[model samples]
Target: MPRILIAILLSCALSWPGIAQAWGPLGHRLVARLAEPRLTPQARAEIDRLLAIEQASSLADIANWADDLRANDPDLGRRSARWHFINIGEHDCAYDVAHACPNGDCVVEAIRIQADILADRTRPDAERLQALKFVVHFVGDVHQPLHAGYARDRGGNTVQVNLHGKGTNLHSLWDSRLLASARLGEDAYEARLRLDPDPLPAGTDPYTPGAPAVWAEQSCRIALAPGVYPPRSRIDDDYLLQHRPTVERQVQLAGARLAELLNIVLATEVSR
Candidate 1:
């Protein structure tokens, strides 16, 4: 290969790793922050103990650990990158494990696996800590509508769009743009989301059997919802206005569900 061509290939290789994350840092931190206060006392203590292995102060501090690992740890990154999302068909909003995720390697399956590991007391603390990080991140990934979108577009990574005069792909737009467009800091965003009327009732458990599948399906439905996919790849204030509620709701749901999963898995002592 010519020197220039080799350089171009190397650049693409470096950039690809950066783009593999969902929700970006702010969104993941927001989810972790929201879930933090909701954890049961036992769950909180367990989380703190496990996280101390890395000398982290809070869930939010380590919320993006999985994404960071993708760039710094090549072997682990290659093995885990695909666990971030699953691809359903363009016309299909339902999740069929056999068809959509045949290998059981997608986000839904990742969540289930991590939850089990987190709940297994016999596992090493370091192993359970890694599971906790994934459970935090994948829960947020499942709530991002495009993460559960059609594979034809690589979850909209190929669908270019101009939002508010800035050029970007649909996946990046949902991953960070819309949330950033709100212009609210993380605390403000969390506070605003707290006011949403659709509360997770006091005793709700979001981790029932098949619940991860249900969550991914809901995201697929949102991706296919009217006005979500703009014609001609141009989005303006109207599009943002239309979808802001969905974004807010998804974040809220992710946070609440993450808390429920942690409470169940971490609060109770797991019998070997």
Candidate 2:
């Protein structure tokens, strides 16, 4: 009896670590940030519509349907809870952000996928809502710092580093660690973020595919920089201070553009 209990415990311990590492910090931060009221107007309307549907349906049903649909679309590629996973040798990390055939604006693709799934009025309300949530979650992911990072390094995956004595890759740490230490909930963080309201750069248009080029360029700045992993001692506070502007800016851009895209998606339907 004791041996059986020990074996079960060991199995769970091993599995738990793998599961924990999967989403990393960036994933969690994205999920957390989505709870804000900053979604694009279209996303806001869709979210309202989704909330109504969810109230009438089970989330589990929605999850299953999304999983099935994503599996059928090979072009959509991997459904990451965090970064946008691109095929490393096959796709150029820095191709023309617009008109980059097949894999260019993956962020746009994620939104469109959600839109198509939700457009199917016949889907169960529960399933439709789930699809909507996935859309919301995915758009947020594509905007993250390292999501659009380099391909040869798998977005810094090749650079190994230690996080407070724990062995993990640089990409993994950026995806999560850098943001987790912020210690601010959505409201507080968003409030602080709004302190210096800078409009999107002059001449920058969110609707154009050019939007992503802007974001990719931002990520590229930090892609190979030493900051991927700060010195072990600076891991907590200094890293946050150094990268806060970049981190905050990315989140801000993501929220604003998310609203912009959502507005575009729902305009035709909402107008009706």
Range of the 10 consecutive residues with the lowest summed lDDT in candidate 1:
12-21
Model 1: clashing residue pairs?
none
Q: After best superposition, candidate 1 residue 233: deviation in angstroms? A: 1.8
Task: Give the Cα-based TM-score of candidate 1 against the true structure.
Answer: 0.91
Worst 10-residue lDDT window for candidate 2 reads: 14-23
Q: Which tens-of-lDDT digit does each residue in 1-272 have in candidate 2?
A: 69999999877543321112312434334433533354445655655666765463322223223223334652332333222432222243453534432543354454556656666666676666755656545445555555555555555565666656667666566656656667776457656766657445422545543454455545555554566545542254555578766666665666555555555544544442
Off by over 4 Å in 2: 1-43, 56-83, 87-93, 96-108, 112-131, 199-204, 225-237, 269-272
Q: What are the lDDT scores of the predictions, listed in order?
A: 0.82, 0.50
Give candidate 1 regions above 4 Å deviation.
1-20, 269-272
- How would you encode candidate 1's per-residue C-alpha lDDT over 1-272 as one tens digit per residue? 89999999877664442354678888898889888878898899899888899999898988888888866886787778778888875548778788877677789898999899989888999999999999999999999989998887778887899977778988888888778889999889888887777457647655665789888988998888877779877778887777777787788788888898898777675432
